[model samples]
Target: MAIFKHLRVSDGVAAQGDGKLPAGDPDPPPAADGAHGPPVTNEPGSTKAWTWRGDFGASLVVVLIAVPLSLGIAVASDAPLVAGLISAVVGGIVGGLIGGSAVQVSGPAAGLTVIVAGLVQTYGWAATCAIVAAAGVLQLVLGLSRVARAALAVSPAVIHGMLAGVGVVIALSQLHIVLGGTPQSSALDNLVELPGQLASNHTLTVATGLLTLAVLIAWPRLPQRVRVVPAPLAAIAAGTGVAAVLGWDVARVDLPSDPLAALAAPQWPDASWTSVAGAVIAVALVASVESLLCAVAMDRLHDGPRVNLDRELTGQGAANLTAGLLGGLPIAGVVVRSTANAKAGARSRRATVMHGVWVLVLALVAAPAIELIPLGALAALLVAIGVQMVNLSHLRGVHRHGELPVYLLTMAGVVALGLFEGVLIGLGCALLLTIRRLASIAVRVTPQHGGPVRVAVDGSLTFLSVPALLRALTAVPEKAVVDLSLNIDFMDHAGVTAIDDWRTGYERSGGTVRIDEVREHWYAPGRSGLPRPVRRTPPVRNRAAWHPLAATLSGRRQLEEGTEEYQSHVAPLVRPLFSELAHGQRPTHLFITCADSRLVPNMITSSGPGDLFTVRNVGNLVPRHGEADPNDSTIAAIEYALAVLPIKTITVCGHSACGAMDALLTPERAGNMPYLSGWLRHGSHSLDRLATRPDGPDRLDRLGRENVLQQLDNLRTHPAVAAREAAGELELCGGYFEIAEGRLHILSPAARVPV
Candidate 1:
């Protein structure tokens, strides 16, 4: 066993990953040699490892479970039982030796059962081996070109749909074998002949199949101690005993005790070259895709090492080639064994390799005992797995996300037609859904008070959206002026023609339509037949990027199609108020609050500029009446707003995440600046109020509410404020702003509630 380690060459030194270090986080720290993580060398017994004992134990458990699964998948795929054992050995040895992943197990996966069956039926068994070899070459080339990741670029819905389709096919065909009837050639044929198969099954064969199925389905619910034997093994063991006692005529796996003497040689294909070539490419693509996806899922198990997908692909290719040469079943990464390996505390790929070695040893040493597994028992195990593959929970999750249509369409196509056709239709559905989303439109018709009705359209407009847009436009009052605000990202000729035709008809009926394009020109208006050159809107310039007078004309076209109410209507209404207040201002209240942009004093108080005097600071804190500090910005504003203006009340407000309150709680923040730090000394009074509550994430908001009350008290300390309030001529109050709800909350002595 090798120690858990990794390396990367940066500068002159190799960066190393320590297994003990925290690496599970998405953002890991820079490596020791300061290079992005690179591959570590894999070796055996380089040193006494931390988890050698655990890895060894895990290997034993995995081999026991893998043996039954391998045999069952081979039976389902119609391959020779020895081919399953051969694939397992080659997968463990070749795949584990050179794979990029640390612990993902490669073996004869059930995912490829349908593909293998099709290949074997079309070509002879020996020629199918040749096709597997050809497919391995494709995988090797793909890995060498570092395009393994590209296999996962297809939509996950399509992949899952294809798998579910395969599952239904497996269950339908394998059911016939389980019931002691010969299976039909295809899923469609199986479905048509299923009723006849059910009517004419041997009584003893049905009993054996039912017993095997019951054991498999009930094994998970068994007591933990009794489950020490794996589910597949337990089910097969029970079926074998029952068949012997009843003297049932059931099919069983036939294998020679001397496995080496029974190995067959690969033969060249005698079928059409086109059909053979298609099978080879399909096998290669499907196998590579499944392996890569399994490796990615397994990566979350260990922080010890990240997988190199390209290298893992190369490893799988090598393993498959070796398996094919030996006339074995094709192999790919198996998630069940990989998950078991991870759970069993596998620290390295050594465990993965050892599991394969164990299977090889078992096949050669105990071939007679392995031959006792009943074919109906294996089919029973496969039936359970096939049902699981069409998981209803996963389908419900897909349905919740509006993807049921795609999944159902793919499944139906595959079950009724073929794999290639089903996948094409599924992919085609996904593409159409994507196109629909990209060409969707959102249109709103708002009737302005004593003004033209505003028809606002957002998102791209294509031919698909034209009919809906036309229907929506018909509701606008006849012979009325319409403000058409189009903020479209893209527009095609069909869309342009629809809108132009509608506008022409509307105008012909004495209705007026003004088209204002936002951001960029999507189409040329009034010149509908001509091809309009598309152009992108220029990026807005920042203050630093601005030239002399570009700001003056920027909003002219934008305001014509803008969402800002001030630019369209409010500014004109407020100009008269601004003119009257320009000479001098008289406000009734002096409002003090945080300088956060969202905390607008006028908006919160429902007051115009002339209605209230404003004072804004970091925390809305007020110092007690005493000697003035060097930082007097807030105090100066308060004094002027109180003495110079006709202010009748003083309102102090604080808000969530008040910078001053946070600074008060965390003292270290004050270390860098002496002036702002000293200025925040007024906020310390709010900390004294914190003893009322337990310390937690909500402490800042609690302290902020208290700070406002403290500031209100501080206002009373000022002689001018005290004298006016003493005479009952002025009012003082406190409040905090709730950012989430956009409501002002008053902090009363008894409780804080929204007003």
Candidate 2:
């Protein structure tokens, strides 16, 4: 059986009997040659030396490209050319020694050009270096704490799309340089001058650059053996050689006098409180973004090998800190070089270190030869690199996924503003798109198969949802029984009001409605009642029988069913008033009254349930049908009583000094009392009704009666009621409830009457 050891690169490998290779050893064995292999103490001794010969050819080609790129990026970032070389060396050597991914190469990345330039312009170079040191420390801490996992939490789509966007930006910016035109320092300036730059500089240099691009595109299609050479390198070599031999008068990097003397330690800046703080934040963010992105790419390429992102970040930070101290710019994990290393058969961190060694050796030995390379040629190389980074395929994928708006908006924002701000805007758009997708589906309230109609609203319902409710209610079959249930935790006032209106309308249209368990509002705990000035009592304990009735009464216990208190307190008064209702032409009228106990329809109409055929609910609401299935019972009962029983007159009695009415009158009070405030909006018509009535009694009383009258008018608008009324069989009446005197006054054309 193989003894599993962490030191072995492959899983399930046994450790050697002797203490040799240990975990965390930076120098590990190469997978090919046995020379200079680190001995394995824990894992079975496997003598394998990492081969560099196979990659020598590829590495040579990469160095050609890397040299030019390093200089160009340094120039772009407003840093000394040696800074780029230092970064490349440190990134490869120090980063490779500590980084989690074996094949990833670290260097001064082009993506940092914009950030470094900005930092230099804002804070002096010294401060930026200090910040870079701090950022390195932060990355080290992050790696030790394993905080790099957070980078993986970003959505795959977002990361890919971001990379694609970055690619496009890079490609566009390089176009000017490729055509032998001077590049603008700022992204905005470059974009603004692109067309004019192209128009003015349409020279042979442009043709040569395009031809180079074409050759790069066709290189992969060449024979399999020939395909080993990367397209970009070949393209650069061809383009640069042609331009040089032809002596094209194109823009080129002019080597400074005493290039070797420029490679000195960077001066440390005065670390002020503000400058340090700003630089640290900027460096941390930029480095984190770049390093984590490279780590993720390497992870995918490794077939899901866990990447120590924090370790990678720490390596990056360390590199940056060293680079800053050595008078070099900040550095990060560069995708181009990392990819190149991976493709070149790098088996361990040795390849990265070797790449750094190569850069250092070349810098020391071939410094003069590097000066011979033209800036325009390097610019063309950079242009090629930038073009390769642009991922048009990813953009197409985003469009295909129906996230075109996100793609376009993000691209536009990045192009117009800058990277960070553009990403923020894109995030906002993405959130909005998510909400819209969630909101698109309507909350359906309908009967379940062989069960009561269930109204299912999965999301938030607000004023904006009113039209949906209205449309839904109007679509229900007028004759079918409905069980309206509002199973939502959050419902706004407009939604509640819409529900009330629907209830009233559904009942009037000869449909049944029922309201299931409705959570009580904190301020207004009882059922929704008429606007009135009355003392409120705590709700009764037994809810099954009385809760529904009590909710309809808005906490006034005077009209409770099966209660000795109600019989003693309210029966005597109602019996006398209802005597006239008993003999009033077979009770051809049904009045739906507010649940407020003080506004008893019997007292107002001088009728019993048999005489007036009354139905009561909190706020005397007529909510739209099918808004919720809980309302089905209430609606069905009303429809059965009005349409089946075929009542001639339907009245909605509102009372003065009513809770619902008062709640509606003062919005602040409603705010203080949420549930009641939401329910009270149903009674807004009371204000209109009161306005139409002449001043009489207390204003609340007048308004209460007027509101009842207005509700009567609203009831007439119901399809069933309108049809019945048009047939000369139905009529509407309005009445006001007086809580103080325990009296109900009906509103007649001539005068108010205590029926």
Candidate 3:
């Protein structure tokens, strides 16, 4: 066992960048030395040493399940029973020793049964083997050329549909054998003959088949300890025992006296070269796809090494070549055996090779015992496997992604025509769907009799949509005004040329046209001759007029112009978010700040559109629960915040050079201003604290920090605020922003001064 374990070759392995091996991730160097060590699972993305103990135990579990499944798949393909065991051995020994994935087990999968059966019928058994060998050579070339990853680009819907179609064909044909009747060649023929086969009486065979299926279904639901024996093995054993005890006359599995000596050899077919080449390509593509898909699925089952896909493809090619020359069925990575190996704690490739060794040994020594098992039992087992292929969860996912049409057409093509034809149909459907979606651009023309006509274009603007744009433009009357707002997310040269030509021709006829690009500038750059933009860069907003010059216009005119700019350029882009917020506001923070013109809460906090619930009053004050007038709007706002919105944090922000704080210090400043003096009374608490703690660079700065702290204390006076704070559900924070330096300081209760 240990001698065979050293045969794992380092073909595509390379050390990762972190200077440490990934835990249980095998990337052995060329001499195969230092491969074994103490296994440990460290932090995420860390490496551990490989262990043989896990591999040895996992091989036993996988081999037990592989033996029965291998024989059944070969029987379904209408080939010699020994061919199944031969493929099993080659898939494990050659495939595992060099394959990319650490734990995925390869064998004769049920997915290729229909293809193999067709090959055997068209080109004799020996000639089919020769075709398989040729396909293996093609796969080797593909792997070496590093095109293995490109196969994954095929849609998963097409792949799933192909498997489901194959499963249906296998189940239909295998059902005939379970019912003690000969199966017809195609799936349709089998269905047409099923009713008559069911009418004929075959009580003993039916009993044996029912017993096998019952055990297969019931084994999984049993206690965990009893299920240590694999379900397939247990199900077959029970059915065979009953048949022998009843002394029923039934067809049973037949094997040569010496299985190794009776192995078939490949031979060239005497058919057309074109037909043979098609067979080879079909076999190569289907087997490659099945094995690659299985390797990806098995990777999610273990925390061991990630599969090296290109290396795995090369290994599978070598295995298929060996299996074909030795007169075996085509091989692929089998999910059942691979899943068993992973669940049984397999850690390395040693388990995969050892399972093959076990199968080879059993075929050489256990010929007589295997012959005792009935063929009906294997057929019954296959029926269950076939039914499971049409998965409901996969159907739902296909529907959700809008690929149901492709999936259904592929499955129908495979069942009615063949696998290759079905795949071509599916690919065609997917291409048409993609082209339709890309060309479906939106062009709306809103015409006004005496005013400027509005034309809005959305979606990708390509050559396909150029006609639609021109038709909408022709609707506007000659010598009329037009506003063409292009909110295009993507565009090509043809689309740009179409729009430019239309605008030039229309303006020559005495029409006015204005263009506004909302987000991406795909048109303006080309029209201005500023080196046609290849990338969709955002249009920068010019803020030169934010503080307009006296010669330019008054401040009121500047504000009105800003509003017009927002409506023409920014409104369409932000409309989606604003539409959702129109229903209600769900602000998470309640912000209390001074009513100073310089303090913009949204800009300072970096929030936009219904993020902050703000309350601005004189002194940035939050009066104690009942101190102010009963009709106070500030108190009412706080009560509404606590009662309605999901407010989690309450922030009080104070700033430097505050006019309110200066007013608080000098009563004479506000002596004549009645409203200003009345609002200054709220700063009395902040004034008392200023005298107790006077350590600052300036009186105004010191008063600002004290006011922020005093307001936080006053907020706790509310019953809801006090209760939520005591329970640790709500938080209170203080911040002070300096105007000159543009810096913010966070204040805590322990420190009277800002830090």
Candidate 4:
């Protein structure tokens, strides 16, 4: 006993907010930052020291991907190529300095291309720039009002469907450019003109576009070192290089002789006030939603400081204002470069800011080199990106939530009608679906040959379901006899009155009706002219009916009443589960525990039917192979369970203040009871093990834990248990239950106490 005196134990399970742990156990340790060291504090306004190496390297990786994408987006929007470059620089520098997100990169996004193209067509480029600036001002006001988070209340299905529709439109229009032809005004026109464009052979342009697509598809499968260069840059460069060397006649990028001379100031539109205001609001809301959603999405890619959405919205407004003033396209957070930034090991906002500086340098010095790229290659890149936006993963998620109809309707509306109208349609459909689900109810009737006919009602009962409920009640014939059970979870005033009126009429038609409410007493209160009960819990039963009192009733009478209660209230609810498991069982674990009146195996394990195979005996003992009585039942039960069932694990449980352990302490008390004394002999090894350790305050608790551990060892002495354990086909565990504390402590095999 002295060897075990210094052992320490910790709680495995205890009541929440109990303010207690094992006597000498230490508190759990804090989580570590990473395998390297503590996180670097280089966020936008942080005061701690900065780490430059990771951020500088990540910036170089992001800048290479941003330059070509900016040129392509501007081409697709029909804006001057320099406008795309201007927005990239402004978004990176200004957005990185003031935005709430630590690593999200901002630039012109593909999602805004449809709206921007329509605006430019109607108002001209200069007027479109003014509208963008106005939108920026509105965004700034909304951010200042601290209503940024409320924007996320819009349904995710609508947002995703809108993006998918935009992708479809972009792909249809850009496909014409890929075939060396001008795109038509709308998606439908582009689709209709596709065959005519395909008939006229533009061999060199088609060759370059196909080459670009091939390179983009095959780039990811290359070696890691080769993939360090992005797929977009490599694909475009491959197409451009082959078209240059072979003297192929393809459409090349056309930029102004001097890139700095392309900057232009925006002008006010000549349209009416209402038209201008509508365009401004559309740009503001779309940009705000896309950027905020992108910020939330990028947060999942890193363990950095969370995005401050309000600050992020304000920063996006500032960037757009600068872009619109300098003749750049509308700017928002971009997912492509942000993913690259995270994958490149960016630690802070420094990476985002530095990447913008690199793009500024590219626009200044590499204008001639960028002009060498073919327009066909850029068109091919946009086509691939547009097609990917209709993601299959998004479709599967919406289908699982039963929102696929809303999603499909929104997408169809956006493509056929317009973006705003499509979103309104989606909102209306979602409202209707919600109302339909809330008003659903079900009623079922069953007839017994000799007993009363059983009728059950489930779900919420409201005025919407009253008509349906009455129709179901008509299914019962004039009702010779009836047992009506109301298992409804909710009932309104109209519903209770309906049920009461039916019962009164049925009884008057020469029939007997007995009403039993399992969940609530809605009908009882309504018939008594009393107000409905505020609490949802069922009415409490009288304890005196089943309490073990000799003066009140005999033991047989109490047992019969308890059986009747179970049959009347619980049988119908559990009937389905019992019917499913009636034919066979495949329990995963075999539970062995004491046959104590207070220790319920199922309650302690929190397992339902067909989850555990249980064995119970006094002292919770298992006899060893060498030492066993002639008619041993515990050993035979173990053999049968291991041989017949698919049991993965076996558990031995012992409890505190156990009567068997107390009897072992004073064996003379059980000398007169032969059968009890013989059964207690199987726990002799536990007493020997306890004797070797020094006694402490909780001797009974320690002996009970030792008995659980000893029983696990005894189980291994069987040939089947030993062979299965050695082959890793089975596992053994020990648990000690403290009756007074109502806690179960898991025991470790290597130690004598619970761990």
Candidate 5:
């Protein structure tokens, strides 16, 4: 809950890519910069009375657009014509009263057409209403929980693929109605009968449908004043005229003369719990996502109050609950009406409430006129909407991101199978794409000036990428030295065997295959086929961290003496965790240690990159508190580490075999080397304390522990460390590494037992 407190409220401008609008509706016109801003009104929370006249006028504009779309969506959903109007009325009144978005119009949306249709087919129209009611309950729960914003995180690829699939299915099934025939049992059935329907003489309904489709396409490009009537309304009116003039026997919408007769009670779903749950979740999630997306788009076109996403979700739920109970299709924030409302300059949510009032008034007053509208005309409208869903622009965009296959597969699946199946397939494909990208391997071969090709493989070279690797290897010219460089993080058994087999085969074919590794060691130097055997740490008496001496002794040392232990043992144990940081480190502790070879702090302390900000020198020391000496590199590293990193802990780790300590403790110092003698001066206090130790012979070991405590005291003198320690944000710890015994001990005030 705390993590989500700062959840972002985006304008969802890119959500238009999700196709929230009715097919073919141009993007909402943008308002002039500050046209309705400050000079026209006060800031967002202003209490000035709004212009009711302006709101009412704008309500009429949205009502004109919502009526035809609602009717068409209901028809596509296989519900009575009045069900669409009921949804429009309830969405306007209930949602407007409580919605977060002031200008967004709430009604039946194109996105839910296929979902509603399927519900109607499975459980009948009355039971489908119950499903809508159940979905509304879910939406209410999500909104109240304040998790509604999280729904917007659904991948754009899945959403677009889903809508495109819905569009294809809607077109195929509704094409049957446009051709003067009832819809088939399934999309596949409809597709099979489509050719036969085309061959028959269904002339009049086809003519009406074609004219309706034509008007919808042409109406928007007409003269400015005439365009006030929405394209859907204009197209429907023209189609009605054409049908009446021809005296054709076409399937027409038959609504009761008295609108009250449209009311129907919800029926309990007669199905298994799993199916019912699926239906409820589907409607709730899809409606919530689409509504929220529309609300965000509406906020962009208006200068009024921005949409409070949770409240918008709650409002949609209330409207859907009301619509479902009243025998209506489920409702959401309709983008077409929402965008139109903003463009018309509606002052408040009053415009949306009034639009609902208009729809209710129209249903009673205009029942006879509504009954005259032909089903073919509505089907034709749906056809255009569906066809628009197979968007070329959206396709091109998805293709650029390599998601074209997802879109195509989804669209095909919907047409061939069903809505949920198509969506699942598309989501599966998108998931695969994401996984491939995350686990992607890059195999490159650069032809050198005079040498053979330099083959480098980056990322996790697992079995999935073996085919490509083999092809690249096969392309190498014969009798050539292949400089193979593997900058990979992981290589499984299959990958290792494939590469090994290829290398041997290539070398046997008169070619020299030289294998080199940057991050991963494929195999040992002499043994080329198998992975190098490693000596894993054995159980210790105290179960402590890996001892540096043990690590150094277990493995055969490398040809290079100093790095032998690390390269063969320590490096392998740590490379997997730190190889990604080959780029950089973001350590929190600045571990200042001596440069003595045997004193391996990482091996003793069990630390890696990003765990520590380290500075090693002759004597692990901090020079002065508030002053910077240009010659002191130790002081400069301290300052840089403290300032640049999120360093909370500063550790000065001193050791037993420290040459710098010996130089300081000895009577005969490096008299010939003045620079070294001067550098040893920083540890003078630790040397003076060593002589006072009661243990005479073991004073050298005691000096190591005392030296760490002295460095810790020196660290506090720095202004940066002092300030942070005072604020209780930074910690200064004293520690020493016992080289001969291969153990570590902590020194708070004095050296204690091994820690």
Candidate 6:
């Protein structure tokens, strides 16, 4: 009745003829102390009491495993067994208290065993310890400065691959220890000895190791209650028990005389500075990798929260320093143990602290009993840990993705060289691949509907991307109006030149080229920072009333015929084209083209001087309205043709095989000629449009045609042209001058005009 709370207890008791009390309140009664149960702690999910109990239970489990493993790992590392135990205790106590994550358990790990052993042999234990302490200080500094995120910047593939390689090394190296055989001095030796050892070793020892591995692997699949028991612990206990009962002469820990005697505090010597410095560096690097990896893993496991990595590093550093002071080996956040604690229902850092307490109690009170644990069995446990870390499925996936070269190189490099060196090589390769990817990028060319051929460039277009762009542009028909818009997010010098050259060539062959809005200063102007304006002789007020002799004398060819020979020869030859203009006859259209020798607009247009008024430039560009300087002779000619010549239509023509267009199309050479590159970008739009078309002589023809249309559009922006066109006093047209065929193709009035 009391358990059910608010039940009719009095009535139930009366029915039973025994009255205890009446439960009248709806709420449950307070505990025996007349207070509500302890308020819930900040631990994740569980209530305070439940979380505390879980921590105690998980800690008990961790301690049972940490003690034996720590001692064995230290012995394997060639450091004093006490060092490992001290590290575990300090890592558990300090790291748990100060570190950012709640569930992480810190202890000496197998990954660092080789490094520790080597450093101890070379630097001596005291110096090694000092180095470890220095590393700790470094880590603390890094953590305090909040730069621990630097570790995350390392590529994920490289990090995982490195860890997998380490897993292999650990598994291979521990095989000898598990078989009651001493491993060789170096990893290479160990690798070479593997085949012989497998062949000659006692089948019984190998069988025992294999069985141990199988149990650890299978244990996780068992029921939840049984799964709570650490697999490594179970494997060790079973293997050791079997070895003992079978009377196998397997290698076992060589306990010190008075096992507790080795537990003295670590001593620092004046001469130990060198060793200490080395150890600290090694420890800092190893611990940082381990701790940060564990923190990231923990963040994933606990979907609700994440750890502050810098704070975590600081805590780990403090732990290592404490461990060194306590005669312990270096420690790091161990992923396996942290994961185990989480699965065991640990809700807070209290679990880590509790685990430390258990290590302390067992080390002080039951040191003798722990000595019975066999080293071979511990080796088996490590072999299992190493296997678990390999992530074979992920490796297989990497291989399937055709990244085997990178994967294998990383694996082989790490195994053959060392973790850091191998990873660096892999990183270098990855960087090369990245650069290749960037270099291979090409401009995106899209065809527009009933408009100029428009091409869009997304990534940076540089010299590296030129060939591809050229091929794309040349693919389009030269007759298409190329609304070549170099709306580029980024463009280098080479890209500018390629575009310019393409435009020049295209315009020379009679193409309409239009460049959309360009970034200001993308191109430079002439000496006056503006396009040179076209100049023309004052127009006759009344052509009909003008004298024939004066009109003939004022024509372009006549003006150039200052010499008597020019007057007597060239002027007479050109007299026919000028006679109509002299009599006040107006040409219907004007043609604009490049000044390249290959492109003679008059010859391509097949129009005599009076029939076709033309302006020529290296890159046939129409200066924006008002951007023309007074001295820009080309501009003056264009203005005169548009405003004073009584021309009804204007044609901006481009030609193929033009040098300036070629320059505009190639941007890589921009750095060498900064001003020219900047100037050439003005024609980039037409070049881009050309790039979208198919490559061929025909494509160049298309570019030339498109360039003409673009120029016509450019003319429409001119105030006089716009006003005249709007007033129906003038018309606009684009023409493609094909240099190869020695022909002109008119691209307006719904017909292609041939010359």
lDDT of 4 by residue, 291-348 (tens): 8887887777666578999999999888888888888888888877776777677767
Model 4 misplaced regions, further than 4 Å: 1-51, 442-466, 473-592, 595-618, 628-652, 655-680, 684-755
Q: Lowest-lDDT window of 10 residues in candidate 5?
A: 3-12
lDDT of 5 by residue, 1-755 (tens): 12211111111122222334323222323346633333334545433334455578889988887887788888888888889999999999999998899788888877888889888878999999999988988898889899988988876667767777776677777888888877887778888999998888467888898788778667655788987777778888999987888787777888777788769899879899999999999999989998887787677665565789999999988888888888888888876677677767686899999999999999989878887788899888887776666555567788888988888887777667777888788888888887786557777766644545557677676777777778776666777777676766677766788878888888898987776555546544223565453431332222112222334432433223226324543575778777788787678888899888677766788875678777988867666564435767888888888788788888888888777777777847677888777777777778766667677777666777788877788888877788999999998887888766887777767434346
Tens digits of per-residue lDDT for model 6, 1-755 = 01111111000001000111112112223345543334546766535666577778778877766776687677667787768777888888899999988677888876677667777777678756766676778889989999888877765556556665665666677788766577877667888998888777875666667667667656656787886566667776777678778887655665565545675454454555665565566568767876787677665544323687888899998987777655567788876567656656666788998898788777777767666667766666666555444554446666665555566677667778876677778788667765655566444454545444555444556667778778888865676556554434345567677777887788877776665322222222221256422321221123223323335344643343235224432575677767755777466677677777667665555566567676777667776566556676767887777667778767766766766666755567466987667556556567666776667755545555656655666667778888988999887766666666766666663333344
lDDT measured at residue 614 in model 5 versus the true structure, 0 to 100: 76
For each candidate in the order shown, give its overall lDDT on alpha carbons. Answer: 0.76, 0.60, 0.79, 0.79, 0.75, 0.64
In model 6, the number of clashes is: 99
Q: With candidate 2 superimposed using the best TM-score fit, by how many Å does residue 675's alpha carbon deviate from the native?
A: 69
Measured with C-alpha atoms, the lDDT of residue 619 in candidate 6 is 69
lDDT of 2 by residue, 1-755 (tens): 01111111100010111212222222343334453344433433433323344245435545654665677677666666777887888887888888887656778776666567667777667656666676777777777777777866654345444443544455556667667676676567877888898778877767666666666556655787885665555665676677678887655444445545665554455657776665676566666766776766655433213567777877877787777776677777766565555555555677777778788888877776666455555555555455444344445666777776776666566666765656666777777876665444255655544333445443455665567767776766665556554434345566667777777787887876766422223112222643422332332234545333344443333332235334433465578767866664455677788887555466555554666676887767654433424645446766777656757777777666776666655678668767666555556766766667577557755555556656666566557877887898877776666666756566784565446
State the local distance difference test value for candidate 2: 0.60
State candidate 2's TM-score.
0.53
TM-score of 1: 0.64
- Name the candidate that leads on TM-score: 4
Q: Model 2: how far is 693 from its true place, Å?
A: 99
Give the winner by TM-score: 1 or 5. Answer: 1
Clashing pairs in 4: 1-692, 1-693, 1-694, 2-693, 2-694
Model 2 stretches astray by more than 4 angstroms: 1-47, 50-65, 123-128, 153-173, 202-211, 247-261, 267-276, 303-305, 400-403, 434-755
Question: lDDT at 483 for candidate 4?
Answer: 68
lDDT of 1 by residue, 386-448 (tens): 665665545776687778878888878877787888888999999998788766788888875
